[model samples]
Target chain A: MTISDNDDGGGTTVVAGTTGRLTQWSTKRNRWIDAIGISAAIAVALDVYLGIWVTPPDKVQGNLVRLLYIHPAIATVALYVAFPLAALSSALWLWRRTRSPFFDRLAVASVETGIFFIALTIVTGSLWGRPVWGVYWTWDATLTTTALLLLEFLGYIAIRKSTADPERRARRSAIVALVAFVDVPLIQSTMVWWKTLHQKATVLLGSSSQIHGIMAMTFALSFLAFGLLCLWMIINRYRIEAIREELEARRMEDAINDRIAESNIRVDDLLAANTAPANTVRSDI
Target chain B: MAPFALLVLILFAFALGPDRTPLINATPGLFWVAVLFSTMFAIQRSFSLEATEGLHDSIILAGIDPAGFFIGKLLAIGAELGVLEILTAAGIIILYGAHVTSMLVLLFSCVLGTIGLSAAGTMYGALVSGMRLRETLLPLLFLPVASPVLIAGTRSWQAGLAGEHISASPWMWILVAFAVLYICVGVVLYGPMEDM
Candidate 1:
């Protein structure tokens, strides 16, 4: 760390360079990203060939019900991934001072991607609801919680963007993320705890019988696919962010160099003028 | 933190289950009552300890991460809430005849709800730590943030007691989500809150 002194009491300290652990971590994350992509492909294959074609369709919902495999899977992935992203980003903000900018950006990416999948879930859910329940949307516990969860994510993103000070922004946004986590379970329980219109759990803990062999396989594959999608998105988002950060650092270095060069030129001109005056005095003497 | 929490627990016991008889229709109300008092007390006392006796700077200087400080405080609050919850639950079960089909879900929901309250309240406390009317502003900010937790916990408890096909999964998930989100916000904003 380099400590720059100010005449005032405030001392501005910057960690001079990235640490080894960070580099190793980033590399590991990249590898994980690659792994996630491969896993996603496999999941996609399983879901398509097995879930859509190999598995028999529901007698009631018919062929149009193929979307079920993807919808809930995506929704589950969205919820699962959002919590970690928000948490890691927030932790990065508080524990380490230098990582705030990157973490904050990562938090934004997670929120954006979460919103994408959540919106997909809601839209698909509504579509399913329409055919099954004869309604496009209902204020059921599940739906209500989902909407609120989306809003909370939006709030996190909005607050992050609204703040100008990087430190303040990071801290405040992290606070928002922590606060919003309270809703995750509340949203989940709202459906079952209350008399909501949403269906009960097709999958409950300690109850494997609820899931059939083929449907279970499809659900598991769909879950894997969606998980892969989330991992891919997070990795890509992190990479783009790393590049942007590198560029920003380079830009800062360039600006500093320019300033130093300009100052050097000014000093040279002043010395030349002083030498010229001294030469004239010597010549006159 | 301990003293403040104890006070809150005491108040919760008195308010909901007075003289060993739980209030009528108290199953749902008990959860909210506990949450309200606990949050109120926790948020108020959260920063007060740091604010008083010039200890906040010592905490900062100890290299104890600000977010860690918040979490520590929240944990204290949660502990206090846990004790209060146990007492309240006992009273409700004995006095109000509240059923406990799935003790796991009920207790888990209680834990989650308290965590959510404490997590969000910690941030609000820090945000208002330096304000002139911090005590007043803390609830204003915290209550709105924690409304969802209260509603979810209350509803979950009610359904659990009623044994009317209560799906405990959603409430647990929401509580987990709330804890994650609250921790994120607290970590990110601690720098600014500390500066203030």
Candidate 2:
């Protein structure tokens, strides 16, 4: 009954027996993340109130412009999501060399959030653009390249899902994420390199005169809010996936145990039959 | 030297522009066409060089960084592209009545756009390098990725030729973004692709 070579200094570790301590740890992490997420949402609502009610409307765009709460915030989130994904993918591939369920979950969540915001950015951009650029879509550098950026991400996820084996899928997806991550900044500069129909940057962000007062505050708060939400989603997805893995491990263990018990019973029956036949020979004699 | 000869031939094409609209108006399309065709020629040589020389397996066994591998290939492609761009610039000045207003902007855009092209081309090259239908897949993959650079480059160059408000500053940043994207995708993906 004893399993040899136990690694935890031969100490009895109950959590390892069947409880799945790591999965439980992930669940705890998710709860904390969710709490933070709720607070962040509240902060966003407060910031939106401040932005629309308190902050003065742009002299050019006017009161129809409070959409700034979401516009730049979404773009910022999009940038934030890709870099970490690249790092994680690279780390998992180079170091772990195994399909880490944790990293896989993180990558999926990040990309999903990225796609969501990108959609928001595109939609808000169009809504903002229609009032500003007078058209829904233009072949402008900013819009065109951004669309291409999203397509590249989509392609990454597509490849991951299309692959059948989880290990191979993880390895391959990690590669795609890393490569796509490197391209983020390069693609961004293309609009600047060549003449594009898009307008130049008005806000250098954090430059004193570029943005200030209520506008600045709202931007900061909304960014925090969106960032928190992204974090929450990642943590939640990671925990859920960890639980799934735990269940899978349990199922496999149960299956092996059932096979062992069945084989043991067969051995017992054979021994009983052999002993009984030996004893029965005396009665026949 | 072979590349140089190819460069000279491309220069001759620029020189013998259609006797209709001055080369300036027509040069944008021609310039990109030259870039595209030249890039295509170079792309064909990408994996074939290693396969023919039998060095492909050696590189794999040596365990060089996949990103490094990507850069190595891109540099070769970039050098070829650089020569083509320089020739195109010369043609723009000599044959077309164009002035090199901001050499910095022109050079920057050319470099960044080339980076985008090479990054994407190298990735696709790697993907299909071992495939039976590589030649067919390469163009299919390269064209869609290169389209942005073509549209942007042609528009940028046309603006420069027309002596319009050619602010390369904005577009330069855009090209930078494009380059970053391609590099990221290639670097992250190409190593595992080596196995494939």
**Highest TM-score, which number?**
2
DockQ of each: 0.13, 0.16
Candidate 1 structure quality by residue, lDDT tens digits, B1-196: 3354445445656676564445546557655765566667766765677678799888778988777877888898878777867766776566555567767667778888888778777777776565565565555456546766777787677666666444656666677777777777667666557774
Candidate 2 lDDT over residue span A25-98, tens digit each:
76453456768888878977888789878989888888756877778777877766644664475457545455
Candidate with maximal DockQ = 2
lDDT string, candidate 2, B1-196, tens digits: 2454346445655577555355556666666666766676677787788878879888888988988989999989989888878876675577555666656556666788788778777886776564565676556545645665776677666656555544545555556766777787677667767776
Q: What is the interface RMSD of candidate 1, in Å?
A: 5.5
Where does the lowest 10-residue lDDT sum fall in candidate 1 chain A? A1-10
Docking class of 2: incorrect
lDDT score at residue A223, model 2, on the 0-100 scale: 82
Summarize candidate 1's per-residue lDDT along A132-182 as a digit string, tens digits: 889989978888778777777766665655555455666766766765665
* Model 2 misplaced stretches (Cα beyond 4 Å): A1-21, A27-30, A52-56, A81-92, A95-101, A196-215, A241-285, B1-119, B125-192
Cα lDDT for residue A222, candidate 1: 92
